[model samples]
Target: MRNLLIFCYFLLFFIGLSCKETKKEDINITTDDIEVSDNLQAVTKKSKSILFFGDSLTAGLGLDIEDAFPAIIQRKIDSLGLSYQVINAGLSGETTAGGKNRIDWVLKQDVDIFVLELGANDGLRGVPLSETRNNLQAIIDFVRQKNPEVKIILTGMQIPPNLGVEYTTEFKKIFPELAAKNKLELIPFLLENVAGIPDLNQADGIHPTKEGHKILAKNTWEVLKDVI
Candidate 1:
């Protein structure tokens, strides 16, 4: 009976020790999972982005990507101690119709400020003025739907008079009209100091040169600083 009692006690002791060891292993696994989850969260947390969406002009045609106005704007933001990322979603040859189609994909990430520089290609192509206006309005609406608090900076663009006087006049009015209707900040003529200047333009006479982009950045900064 004594021997049997001792054996029973030893068996109970071993069982308790095994259960404790299993619990410790389970705890270690849980701790590792939590650490991994925390690391992933830290890695994915990103700064709010100032998205520059437009065409070849915004894409920095005939210039280095870093020389683009959007990148220059990024430098300005950094200098001001702002915590914002600059995303250049500019595509060469993109028109208002294309922009309307692409805005959804471009806005997949969080955007704090949207600097819209489209409609130049649309005007140059002589696309219907009403269609261009509607497409631009749609893009703006989509951005607002994505983030109701997003601030928009619409940049005005002008084309040569080859598209007929009536078309040119109406095209020029679109930007301000949209700005007024949407209550958005407007940069009248993004190429104010650079347009019509030989030195400021590329060989194609359409896209702005590196020096011209500096002036463009200044124009954008003037209106952008007020909004942000």
Candidate 2:
């Protein structure tokens, strides 16, 4: 009887030791899995995001949310299986001054690229070219100050012929000047191919149609693909 009891005790000790070792191995595997998951999440978060700042032109004015230029660009990126998020900060009827006021809010996001598309409404409203320029320059300066590494893509706007040749010329110069000064990628005119096309524009003759939005997306992608 004494021998049997001793044998039982030894058996229990070995079994307990094996169980403890098994548990430790499981814990280590679980910890490794958690660490891998965390690292993958960090990589996903570091992917690029873009912010589109402009007026109705960028807002898709009369169009649906999915039809907006920002959304269009996002779709294009997704189709290519690229990781990107494009936030549209466009406000209808917003001028350069409005953009200046709201720029801080726009920069609050984790933005990798900023597509500055303001001053179009300023030109439309006949706002002074200097004020428009100052407002736009201030916005660029503020953004650069906050994030020097953030890429900027400046999109130009053209005034209607009714705005007159002299005013139009000065208004058009604002984008190039700012782009050159800041060393930004410039899209000479956002509506280059679609602006005058009757079928591409909405009845208002200001905003672009769905097809027009696609063209604008292509224009943005031309510059964006290289950077991101």
Model number with the top lDDT: 1
All candidates' lDDT scores? 0.91, 0.88
Tens digits of per-residue lDDT for model 2, 97-184: 9999988887875578989999888888899989999999999999888888899999988878678999999999999998999899
TM per candidate comes to: 0.80, 0.79
- Count of clashes, each model: 0, 0
Question: Candidate 2: lDDT of 204?
Answer: 82
The TM-score of predicted model 1 comes to 0.80
Cα lDDT of model 1 by residue, 1-228, tens digit:
999999999999999999999998777557888999965653465366788999998999889999999999988987887767788999999999999998888888668999999999989888999999999999999999999999999999888899799999999999999999999999999999898999999988888999999999999999988877
Show the lowest summed lDDT stretch of 10 residues, model 1.
38-47
